[model samples]
Target chain A: MNAHDLIKEAIAEKGKFDSVYWIACGGSMIDLIPAHELLQREATTFTSYIYTAREFDIMRPRRLGEKSLVIACSHSGNTPEVVEGCEIALAAGATVIAQTDNAGSKIDSGKWTTWVYPWGEGVPQAEVPAGISLSLAAELLDQQEGYVDLADMYAGIAEMDKILPPAREKVNAELGDRFAKLCQEHEFFYILGSGPNFSQTYGFAICSLMEMQWQHCSYIHSAEYFHGPFEATQDGVFYFLQMGSSECRAMDERALAFLKTHTDTLMVLDAKEYGMEAVPASVRAYLDPVLFYAMNCELRAARGKVFDHDPDFRRYMGVVEY
Target chain B: MNAHDLIKEAIAEKGKFDSVYWIACGGSMIDLIPAHELLQREATTFTSYIYTAREFDIMRPRRLGEKSLVIACSHSGNTPEVVEGCEIALAAGATVIAQTDNAGSKIDSGKWTTWVYPWGEGVPQAEVPAGISLSLAAELLDQQEGYVDLADMYAGIAEMDKILPPAREKVNAELGDRFAKLCQEHEFFYILGSGPNFSQTYGFAICSLMEMQWQHCSYIHSAEYFHGPFEATQDGVFYFLQMGSSECRAMDERALAFLKTHTDTLMVLDAKEYGMEAVPASVRAYLDPVLFYAMNCELRAARGKVFDHDPDFRRYMGVVEY
Candidate 1:
């Protein structure tokens, strides 16, 4: 059985949980954002908290308990802190579910009560973890409060896989050339998103721009944009608007209007603008980050045009021992 | 009375809570990080959730109830979302404590059942909200599980207000001259911190550099630094390590070690290096953010020497409609 089936089975045997401790590290930590927002927005039966692995180990919020369902993610499967988080959850009598890119690596050892690997392998412009993240959100919400009786969220996954590639090519063609030039010219950029797209805003800013090309950027949520980050607005400061159909769309629209007057440097990629005719309206918002990630691949390629920098280029990352 | 005494009185009347909802916006939102971390580490009786005011207003987690204490903060006390967050918590039958700098602003206009302004009004290099944040943490921890007495926390704050001015002058004389040259030289910087200091790192990045001079910076938490930001480290990448005495110190030390090998552009300001002659050892870690904030005064002043940009220098902030 897959992740959805496994979770359903776990709930059946281990019983319903009172809370959830969503813990992971780095890019893997970003995977928890959508499911968390969904549960926070929809589910009332259970409460959820997302923590960085070391934060979990050190702080140990009292919310984690026997009735807590801990979802731990690590793409590499060898991240030390993530492995430690899994161990900590297990010791606290919480059920541990590990999501990893590698099936038999360190995180996939006997410690995890159940494990899941990447989905949608080799699909153009797709993030396997993001696909799983959306499906997991749908399934959990479906089971919660009987909102919808989804057989599992695999149907939503099938819909996404079918429609996303065509949309990816179209978005790439439309926005890729323009964004690449902006990337070459601008010294600073702020990627903004809200709700479900929050983690993706952070991921694209750090993982794609800073990590991939050594650019300077920050990920600011649209809802909080007016508070502090909006102060950074000037003619030279660029804003990458990652638009989605989440509940916070109104907030994004508000921020965009404000940005238009202060700075002309804006690159918007609204999933609502894309052609995902096959995916239902019910689940489209939950997958916007996946759609945005697909669009980002082209932008990454565009940066490849101006500079000969590799995403793996680093003096200290994997090269030095500390 | 001060914030601690105010909370104690409110707790006496409203009764103790089993959970905490920490709500605020921007700088005020960052102020809650230290208290949240301390409570998460020490208190097993009360669970805590830190949310941006708008997030708390929108999400309305199922856990919030009559048995919950909601701490809402804003400096101006006129931020719309903060007012709405307090309204939401009040409607949920939760006790609300408003922390604001303004005495009679909208957030202070007959809305909050309890409120607090700064204690030491004219102290040099002191953040009123941060001092309150530490005191709140101590009170919450003391009330939960009968942990260590926290009268020492107040004594530390008094020491900080007294000895910090002289130390600030010293640091300004020693590091200020040198750091100003670096600030003038480098265009990009990554301010890294963890646990209690993480919020201040972000505050210094957004409030000081980005807002004050439109300089580029990203505040990376030590736990999340290794994930993506670590990839940005090379010969020219600058890192400002705002070291505080917290449980996450080891993680920050590890990152600092790796950064030393990779980049020549590294700036470290550890609280341990500063002298607080009167502060007791038991509560010094809780007040490290306060120490760092004091040191930041010199850093902010150093930026003043290199350029003339006001914190209020903006094209859109408070000058136009959104």
Candidate 2:
């Protein structure tokens, strides 16, 4: 089955269950947040548990009577913590599902049910696995709002595809050199997302990890920025604000104003000014910002491969087992 | 005035009012959290609003009341945000009390009431003002708790004074080098706390903005970690877990075990291991952790200054309002 159908089926199955708990680490868990919100709004308590897979065995909540469904994700199924978590949850009498790139890997080796996806030979490196997996899990959890209609999501992806050549040119030709120059001295990034784009911020953060670059990113409410943290924004702070929604218009303006006054290194993607307005609102929320993120991932990967020659490269680092 | 007397006078004068809202940035806000808990326990809903000074005017909550109190804090008395918040609160019909340092800064300039402390040149720059302000605020809001034989608190602080210096030496001597080295490449830190320390984690996270060096630092409950974000620890995500009580002890252990398998960097501070046994068991619930926190603050500041400094540092570049 295609990725979309698989997710829809999972969501349908999850909807049939009375209680659902999602457990995953930072990178994979973020994709589930949007759907988790939908579940909560639908009156499903929808608790999210984020732990190291190894901790899963000890921290698993006790109420595992038949109705609970546990969904775990790891791009590589070999992570030790995830493996341990599955063993503990199954022993505790809860049904477990493993979502991974390699279906036959050890992550799905035990009593846990498994979902697998194809990523071709592109090394499954970069952003695709996480995006697909999270989008799938979100669907399984029945979390898609009207905002992510399947047709529109695909169309949005298509829209992003169209912009890729020019966007790449604009970013590489102008922004890339600037980013590379800045990143050389700066070891961190603070990515801010507003409205629906916050999910993209979470996703973008995860991809950074996948690319094997150590960078910090935060997903904050635009409105909350005016609180004290704004004071911390200095020359070293790189602020990435999503300039799409009217609800967050004030936040974008405030961030713009702060960067104008307080700090010097401000990497902003003024989506409106960039002619990115052609993308539909719903899909663009998930897709457009990623265009910038994709470039970031490429830059970092090239940096690591060409510049750093990180010894841990290429060898999958083979999933971490708890 | 002595800390105890200053608080008593402030509370006595401010208590006559119908409501109180503690306004502050991160560290400044934490001093009031414990007291707020006491007040909230007493069923006093003071409409607490925590925001940056600039946003205070923009996102100010509903007018607290004609007799409401706005307790504003700034260690320097010069932090632009607190000064602005004080102005806004005073203009909004709320009584403004400035908990700050020195006599001449803008935060202390207007019709607002001011509680100033003599600068402690002996203490570290960022902390001296904060410690005094926090101690005073704590004493003020919980005068009953503060003076309920503060001879014990004095002893506790004194004992803490003795214990922390050595403990800081021990942790720094043993783990400091490792942490500094790890931090050089691993840029993200996810800190976890549970139960009473949940708010403590929140406050500590605010203080961590210093070390974040623009990295993302997030703190969540131990229980919540298992649900969604746990899946991301495939290659062993780095994390810090704060173990406060026996209840959350398992979670801490689980985290350590998981980190052992999954992520590259992990630090777990278990109070049981920290010789907190010297603290009176009766008050250990609060004193042990609070005292440890006092040390953590010291250690973090030392570490930030020593290792986390951006070679080139600048402030307030993101966006700010005057």
Candidate 3:
């Protein structure tokens, strides 16, 4: 079933929900952020939260009961913490919507509504985990409390499918080699982003740069830049700033202006410079993270080639037990 | 007025509130986190959130109306974004509780309820910004929805006043020189903490190390360490882990075990090892951040002496305009 239909069915079955929780780990947790942000921005009657799976299990929020709706994701569908969280939610009589790329895994158990989204080569933009989660969030918001921009958000998702592929290629052709060269030259980096696009900033810092490339990095919120992290800004430091087209864009603009004067090695990936203009202005900010995610993936792939290290290679994860 | 009396008066004036927002920037923002976490963990009817002041102003949550209580802080009481946030909250018909160390500053205007907390030498633990915020949160939760641990939390606060001074001095006497040496040897470090203690980890990395000492750093959530940042752990890397006596202690323990195996330079400050045994176990977890904060201040002061960089010194903060 499609994301919207699945969410509709869940709402219909549950009758009412006072809270929605997005639970996952690592990249999966990061992927659900835009959806959580959407609910935070749009939902009035209902509250939303994003939790690292294990912490959710340990904290066991008192509000996680019959009136709660949990949307959890695990790409492998067997992440122990996520599966446990699904079980915890189910035991609490909360409706659970589980999304995964791998089917028939532990998380695919028929106890909850299971969503299998496309992954790997040639996957449409709307079929990715983030897309499915976002669509579900928009639908839930529309059904629960009328979202005026619901139609625009749907159109934006469709526009992403058409524009993201070419945008990724264009970014690769224009800046891939330069980004790769910078990656080779610098061993550490500070990444900045705000609003929904912070998911991309965080994901790139942790998953791609630190985990995949074995580099050290810190991801700072653009809004918090002037507060403390900006003091670390100076020449000879590597910085990558992700500029989004959102209300929070002012925060990014301020950080960009400061970085321009302070740092010589600053790389900026602005969503507006890409093909995001085709997306509806009402929903453009929500889709900015999707554009940033695709661009980062392409750039990271280039860095992998330059450094002679496969992005998929890991020394500790999966190979060692904790 | 005392925090509890002020919160009670505000609740009486407002009649009812369904949500609480803690908004501030930099260390002030970090200080509010424990209170927000306390509400998240204990409050059943009221939802809680922490937001950077500018982001809160830009993304004005739809829920910020008559049914909302906003607790905002700015140390100097003249932070532009925080002052603006208080105005926005007041305009939205929300009860605004403004906390600051300074009097008669913009944030101290009589438009909203202003709270002046103690700062500088020999301030009582219960009168600090974080202590007041946490007390306000506890009082609100107790009066609104019956927090069973309210009395115990108060007891914990009083215990903190009796214990924190000596605890800070002991930590300094025991680990000061070594921590300073580590700071001088390593230019970049990873600080890890879980649950409420994550506030100290973040505040130390951004405020003390990066902002004041001009060192590079990343603050990783203990729960998220294994997810991605663990790959960056190696022999030469420096790591400081804060272990708390909370349900989320398991997360910190796991990270500690792995860090011990991978890194040669690791410093750990466990709340259990400190003099927190005197505090009631029921409220010990909530007060762990307080202990960590005090210990961090002492250690950072030692590092400041060694590096000849005053913790109060800033390169850009008040020196330049954004």
lDDT of each: 0.73, 0.53, 0.87
Cα error, candidate 2, residue A146 (Å)? 9.3
Query: What are the DockQ scores of the candidates, in order?
Result: 0.48, 0.09, 0.79
TM-score of each: 0.89, 0.56, 0.98
| Clashing residue pairs in candidate 1 (N, C-alpha, C atoms within 3 angstroms) | none
Clashing pairs in 3: none
Per-residue error (Å), model 1, residue A187: 3.1
Q: Largest DockQ belongs to which candidate?
A: 3
iRMSD of prediction 2? 8.3
Question: For every model in order, what is the iRMS?
Answer: 2.6, 8.3, 1.1
> lDDT score, residue A145, model 3?
86
Total clashing pairs for each candidate: 0, 46, 0
Worst window of 10 by summed lDDT in candidate 1 chain B: B118-127
Q: Show model 2 residue runs off by greater than 4 Å.
A: A2-15, A37-56, A62-65, A91-95, A120-166, A187-189, A194-211, A214-226, A236-253, A271-279, A282-293, A305-322, B1-205, B208-270, B275-322
What is residue A160's positional error in candidate 3, in angstroms? 1.1
Q: Write the per-residue lDDT of candidate 2 for residues A1-322, one digit (tens) a residue.
A: 3455654554566444444455555545554444333333222222233333534444344344344567677667766567777777677666676677776788868576677756542323222544454354345444443323556555555565556556556655656556556666665555665543555565555445333554444544454454434645666666666564323345566667666676787777666655456666644445544454555555555445544645234322333332
lDDT tens per residue, model 1, B80-175: 998898888888888888888788888887766545466443743234777777777677677656656477777777777776777787788778
lDDT of 3 by residue, A188-225 (tens): 78999998888989999888888888878889999888
Go through the candidates in order and give the C-alpha RMSD of each one to the true structure: 3.3, 10.0, 1.3
